[model samples]
Target: MKQRIVWILLGFMVFMSSVVMAAPAENAAPGSRIKDLLAEWRKGDVKPATGNRLPGKVGLVWQPRLDDATDMSEAERIDCINVVSPCWFRISSEDGTMSHAALSPDKDYVKKAQKKGYKVWALVSNSFDPDMTHRLLANPAGMKRAIDEIMQAVKKYDLDGINLDFENIEEEDRDALSGFISRLGTELHKENKTFSVDVTFPGGSPNWSLCYDRGAIAAAADYVMVMAYDEHPGGSKYAGSVASIGWVENGVQAMLREVPAEKLVLGMPLYSRIWKESDGVVEDVETLWMEDADRLVREKKLARVWDADAGQYYFEYQKNGQLCRVWQENARSIALKASLISKYDLAGAALWRRGFETADVWPVLAAELENSQR
Candidate 1:
């Protein structure tokens, strides 16, 4: 009888170990977590939650620096708007300052965009200058001056809103940063104008990502636009997709913890990165627009294969004694991302910058938007 009781206890211990091991780890990738959740859902171990299917709000960032030397014609601009059908256009028209701000809006482009039924919001940035951002956010006088200039520009340009794109700020200025956004949002709301902020993926390193107090800023702003690309940005030693589905999902989940889904916008990349590696070390990297990426694969006669793990098309070749790899972003990959917006009931999706996407993506996005409304 004693031997039998000891054996039973050992069996119970083994079963408990397996149960604990089967649970998802805290540091698991979003894709892994999703897979586990699906398994649980299949067994009816967990209840699935669904978000409301509201009409999706599409946004685009339009930077003048991306235009060609000859500039895009008004007709061309109108045609582009007709194709993408974005609800908001964040024009790169202003840069932040310590004493005052600079405003540069192309009246012609603004007039054309508004006539096409697009809400025009002036985008202000610190040009990713860390020092400038710290100064502007830290000093109370500087913040007031900057806000005054922004309001003046909004009135002068007859704009509908403002998009704050400040980057590379110091971690020490986190509180000040939130304060500035709060004040700006308060003033902008008074004028009946919308205010939005562009933030990077949460859970990043301290200085690079933790600079923005997402909870505070999201509470203050009308929309919190999360730049979900650059999972592997330029200058990184390793090479990977610009934004994999797993990385994006993880980012959205992280932000959702602090922000309401209605006030969140998931930013998508319309481009990919070409990494040049030699002997297992990445030597250089280049950005490729989706159209150009597709063309390159055909021109080089390289085989494109779907990477189930990354959830994107993969292509690699040897050039000049270096191994070149490209994680191509086509309609299919983007469509998957759009589906996430509906699944999470996010506010909407925003394209990184105008002009990098292929025409095929527009229809896919449109379908996703329609599906979301249902």
Candidate 2:
């Protein structure tokens, strides 16, 4: 998830039914053939997971910019982060066609990352549109086209796998969404590649929380990257840590009930929010990157104090009688969160984004996850 991909923009049903359809006779009528094929689609071709290539691995959610020279280079040199999931494909059409924006995904960057021993699991997103999602799911032809296109892209690019990052879905579509993931995971597994999904915290708004049938999704995909951030996102009643240690731990524990330890990856947020409050009323929430947070703290002359309970440095200052606050994510905070991977014996850790993290953060991740990653 990127800065633009706000965690606050909240967002599966579990319907398990099976049907049987007989194969069409040779030289059968065109209408009969179409009916038989549609029946087969409804029956579901759920395939077994191929298993994770790097179960205990470190991953980074990549937000591709014009120049990824720095990100690509760092990932190459850093041995800890074994997986690179680039934001690549998008569900662009109501008819389920993926949009190919000019150079949205830099193929050369993919090759470079792979050459350096990174397992490139290119990300496929829903663009956070629920109406479009409803139509895409309703149309069997559209759904088929989308899956075919995704599989084609993987084969064409020789990608190691896929990371499904669908957001802002309606609760009514839970079963439909589960079916989509099951089908996609099946196809991906047939190719002998990893399939994963990005999910929000368990108990939140209906758009983000209730829509995901976590247990069913886990049963389908090879891995599930639990986005443990956004505890206090923008437009919240109060300001708090983007990912407090306690809240993150709770989220991880909640996910573990549904997803297996080896099949779950903890997603860490690299950014924090700078909250401006007046008379205890929230005024504005500004998303802050690691370097930006450091600069703002110095410029505003805010005093930084350690919140042992939250396990993050808290900074607050009064400007013109307005209270400004930030729960800063630093190396210490990241180290504490990374420790959860080991504590819970989880699969590994994945940073929310690439460039948002300060250069110094990677070493902490490497150090903490060294034992966690087998």
Candidate 3:
């Protein structure tokens, strides 16, 4: 009888623990959908007003080698005037084996960017935290190890700073991520390297926000890059830009409540998404490259639809009797976003990637920022 009772108690304990772990995060604001939740949060105390600053110059980022190498050119790298080269990504806790495609400053294209006096920064990710974010929530040793490895990489490569891109972490890991970032900021400061984070558009459930502690994250890093796009894609039930104007404004406002305006970098998606209606196949995706966008307009007879609410463009047409949609970025939309930077007094803008920029984007950006003080 005693043995049976003990076994039952053990099982009960296990089940109870599972339930607790599975419960939604505490203080999760109500809303089933991403848009509603974000809207409601914006209505709350997340945003704070601010004094506007001088308009900022535009900064374009290039995610090189990883997406597709066939289209990348040598000349594109050497003389991308007025662009900032953001390294694709480097992973942590692993040995110093860089992936073949991820942009490495030691690599040819990066070297070219450096030679041309373009500003550069190293992008790194534990990316969803892997074992570190979970098992190391309170594990000082593991956190330190991750930090040490990353700082070493930054120094070895002579990077300007690091871009933190950890994503999809569990909620319990939020505090740990904040603690880790605090430590990382200290280390990066010792070497005069800036630290920044890549933030998802603020919405989603407690499940999604579990990994991100906006307050702590903002406090720890020099700047936070809000990826203000990717709201809807080809596979989604609807069509939209990742960051609609309202969404972008509210998200930035949320971050501004905790982070200084000068420390905030608004991320504009230079890419677009595509979805198949009948098949429910959606690709939350990139902008049609200059070459691809041109081919579609000039060669294909599809009509482009402009998303005024979202400040993006898309195409709707029938193929094989199935509806197809393609979302894209062009000189016009890019210019619109750049104008927002000036209007909002944002620190700077980061393009989702490099190389796919419309031929006219640079000229427009340059013209807009030509006389800016910053």
- Name the best candidate (by lDDT): 2
lDDT of 2: 0.80
- lDDT tens digits, residue span 1-374, model 3: 99999999999999976665555433233333333433332222322222222234436474654444422324444222434545555544333223322554564544555566654566765645455446544444445566777777676666666777777667655665676676677677777776777777556544354467776677667677877766663345565565566677777777677666676677776665545456664423334565576577667777777878767677776656566666567778777776666666666777767666666776776654443334
Candidate lDDT values, in order: 0.71, 0.80, 0.60
Residue 46, candidate 1: alpha-carbon lDDT: 20
TM-score ranking of the models: 2, 1, 3
Please, what is the TM-score per model? 0.78, 0.86, 0.72
Candidate 3 has its poorest 10 consecutive residues by lDDT at 44-53
For candidate 3, what is the TM-score?
A: 0.72
Best by TM-score: 2
Give the alpha carbon lDDT tens digit for every residue of 131-159 in model 2.
89876765567777888899999988888
Per-residue CA lDDT of model 1 for 61-84, tens digit only, reads 444343452122233443212212
What's the lDDT of the predicted structure labeled candidate 1?
0.71
Off by over 4 Å in 1: 1-56, 66-103
- Candidate 1 clash pair list: none
